[model samples]
Target chain A: MKKLNFGIISYAHPHALRYASTIAQSRRAKLCAISGDGANSDVAKGEAKKYGAKFYKNYEDLLKNKNVEAVYIAIETYRHKEVAIRAAEEGKHILLEKPIALTLEDADEVIKAAEKNDVKLMLPFNPRFTEPLIKAKGMIKAGEIGALEYIHAISENVKPPIFLQGLDMSWFLDINKSGGGGFMDTAPHGIDSLLWLTKSVPKKVFADIGAKIYGFPVDDIGTAVLEFKNGILAVLTAGWGNPKGYSYGLEIKYYLVGREGFLDVRTAYPDFTVYQDRAEKIYWDRPDVRGIVGSFVTAVLKDKDVPISGEDAKKNLAIILAAYESSRKGKVVHIDL
Target chain B: MKELKIGVVGCGNIFNLAHKPALKNIESIKVIACADIDGERAREGAKAFNAKAFQSLDEFLDLDFDVVEVLTPTYAHAEIAIKALKAGKHVIVEKPIALTTEEAEKMVQTAEKEELKLFVGHVRRFDKRWVQMKDVIRKRNILPMHIRKREVQNLPFPAHYWYWDENKSGGVALDLGVHVTDFLRWFFESEPLEVLGTGKAIKEEAKSNDTFDHFIMVVKFEGGKTGIAEVSWAYPYPSRYGVFYHHVDIIGKNGRIRYTPLDTPVVGVAKANFEMPRFSPLLSTFPDAFERELRHFFECIKKDIEPKVTAEDALIALEIAEKAKESARKGEVVRL
Candidate 1:
């Protein structure tokens, strides 16, 4: 079988190294090249050297390399559209990092570009690949939890050390680059998961986004209440400025209140447990689910539909953008997409 | 016409703490009978309060009582309160009104049809500290209110006692939450427009499926002012020997008023010379606010006026509680 050649566009994203490492370990794909600028380029080169892959200083050069059939765009949020469009134009399949683009127009541009080139465009939302979440979706589909009524998702860090260091990241701290801070960053995963499992789009969103702490230019904490088209309501909270040295955990609790009973999945830090009628019956430990890279490779080799598509990714981004607009305008924003 | 006869239900921790002492203190109220699912509990309560022991609800209702105190497991609050009201008895039910909003509404309807006073035991409303705080807020017109209540789990009861079950107790928010919700409604003088909350069950082997030991809720009222209520059973450390310390701060158009019972100082005289010294009270557990609530219920019955904590008030608090739980469950704001 011909190995799928994969390269990364930038190492600035925290997940970039993981993508590089996953490619290095995967049997279906080979790490082809890495592209970045200055310090990021050096880091990417060092990572490439460690992984025995080529490193390119400019993203354009990496895109032009015929050996790299697919490019994973892990650049800054602002650069996603330009790199994704360029990669698509160069006939390379693209796996773009979340917040598909900072603006709806840029997201639309990337979508148009991918469609125009007839190449695959995947948005990496690794949580979908986690075994427990997979099991949860299956249970919901099989009527294990019955009709889904409510979903409560929480992503919390005991306190990350990042807040102790002054909030000084340019892209992260700026509203223009990051779109919004915590909501734009962590919430998209939950939003996409809700949409995926429920197979529904949000009808309306009410959000409260602001810097509750860590007085930064961008909102470090965000809470959103969404009313889905199916009458299912979801609440999502994201915070970046927790106390230092605390374990980071993501929990999604689905309250599937059925005609007969209820099914709940409480996804703790490392394990996800399913409760049938309030009695926990199944437990899956899925610490090894490398959701981002796993899905990217699965799409390339297995021809499986990418768990997160460009349109789905854009919808999540639109929800976040709507949240921002709601917070600023102090009114509920009707989600059109 | 005759002294209002009352039957005490569920002679458990709250009965011992509040009901026995308060009933002993109040005039025009007689503890005619006592009942508990546990015979020993009924006997203990009867012995403590100098009342007759009735082993079951049937026997308790047979007694000539004008009011029944529904203090059993939260799940039974609705059923028993409705039965008592239908049997021509005023009902003073415990907080959380009922396990679910549907049940609470039914209880309210039964009470209204029977022309009986359905007083929800939101003792915090009658607590000396909370009463003083409410008085200040009402007089000062505090617009935006922030109230927080914290408690370290000294001894957690068995989870089977309805309070721990999400379906029965409505989780921690409904258990300890009704107090804060009722407080906000009373303070704001309006129903909650919306509620957003987050909660989690921390104990690994917790018997009850309701997981959250900590809960935080943000309630928006009709007039644009927001009230935040934080309740937790997972306090990490011990404090000044008080069972629970409640702090409330009401932010208004003019000024902010902060109140904590811990701040109240006790005056004492020294034996040495004639020196008067000020020392804070040890903050012992006062009698349950249940007694005051019950007394108010009796007074309202005599005066032909509505009780302060009416069925509607209880229903409103229960509505807020349910919305907060929904918010915690869905991770979204529930609009009332």
Candidate 2:
């Protein structure tokens, strides 16, 4: 079996390390090269040395390398369209981070490039990879609960990349660079999972978004109610408002209702907490990151459709943008997509 | 320590489950009479309290009770409380002072002109958790910037009940909405400037009523604070009661406070007694807030002081809820 040789573009987003580590340990994937271009270049260089992979000072140089068959692009959000398009044109299968681009036009261009170049464009929506939610999706598909009618999902975190990654994540709070704050960063997970689980398109969105914590220019709290074409009413609350002492720093939960039965799902389930005098310790009972990267690697190797495509992510981004518009205009914004 | 003679009107679910049990625990108050549109429940309630029973408020108001606790349906609150106040009785009314602000104002004015004490049952104000939250915010100067609260329950009544009728009961936006809106106004200590809302019925039983059993309302307060209230009566379907869940998160300038179902330790699995509030079924407990609320009402009547929850405060919450309903209906924000 030939291992898929992978190059990682920029270590700006924290998920870079997860993908790199997964490739390092996998039997079917190889960490062929690492690239850097911005303030995170040194970090990228250090990661390359630690992983014993070739290092490229610029991502284009990495793309120029003939042996790199695939790339996981973890650059900042504003640069997603540019880097993804470049990766696609390089004939490399790409795993793109979420919020595909800042606008629908940019997202469309990236999708067009991927389709034109015949490359698989997958968005790393981690929830789609988690075990419990995967099982929930299977149950919904099997009609375990009758026809799905309503869902209330919440995705919350302790601020952003800073608390989770211990890095300066001020870029995520900048409206111009990241597009929006907590909702923009976190709601994509819930929105994507909702769309996937219900297999429905959104018809309207009404939201109330604001800077509720830290008084940052970008909003820290957002709540949106969406009506789906299938008559599913989904309410999503995404925020960076968890206090310091919460056990699960990243908590995602869902309340699913159907005609016959209901489901209360905690995405961060099968975890344990240890309380000691010095500090509290929390551990995920099973590894959740494995499937996200492994499945993408296998999809590229098998020449099969990726689990979540660029078009699916574009719809997620469209809903997010509609929520912002709804918040701004203080009206329910009808989503055509 | 004198015994305060109290007359309770509208012998319904709340009176039987919350007020009767709580009033029995209070040694300083005695129920002198009970009245209801349903004479059977009124007689049953009188028997439970060892009081007289009457089929009409006109007949009941003539009794020699010092205060009247109006626990009738929300639409009847203003007329009943005003009538009680005019009869020279200090009044204690269940929340949402009236269906409309005009009616709430008339209740307030009548109480003022009659020179009698009027207290509204905004029970969360007396709950220790919320009071402590207020203390933390004020004492620590948390300076709340955004507050989120959600209260959800299975449908407490049958499909044919007034609760399913939007015009009769005002749906969840006015029913459960008032409970949380009152909390938001109290927590922020500022008037709400605008409200944006989205709501739906969601249940097939409510599909014909043209009412929302679930609603999410976003309120912007005067001091640049934000409050979100997501209230629902559409918890688990099939009209099973006794499922209750609530969450509160207060994000402020200096600190954050949150409470979720995970924090609660009590759990029960049963048929979920349909007669009680959703909490009473699973939690197997009624909040002691009811007793504290009754005690405070008695104190206000005795001390001749304003209540912890006043008619004006209730009126403000009702106004916010009404605006929220309008926002949900028009699909736009409604300004105060």
- Per-model TM-score, in order, reads 0.59, 0.93
Q: Return model 1's CA RMSD, one decimal.
A: 14.1
* Candidate 2 lDDT, B130-158, residue by residue in tens: 88879989999888888889887767577
Interface RMSD of 2: 4.9
Q: Which stretches of candidate 2 lie over 4 Å from their true place?
A: A164-168, A267-288, B139-141, B237-241, B262-279, B282-287
lDDT of 2: 0.82
Cα deviation in Å at residue B102, candidate 2?
2.0
* DockQ of each two-chain model: 0.04, 0.35
Model 1 / residue B177 / CA error / Å: 6.6
Candidate 1 per-residue lDDT over residues B119-160, each given as its tens digit: 887777777777886787667665443333332231245555
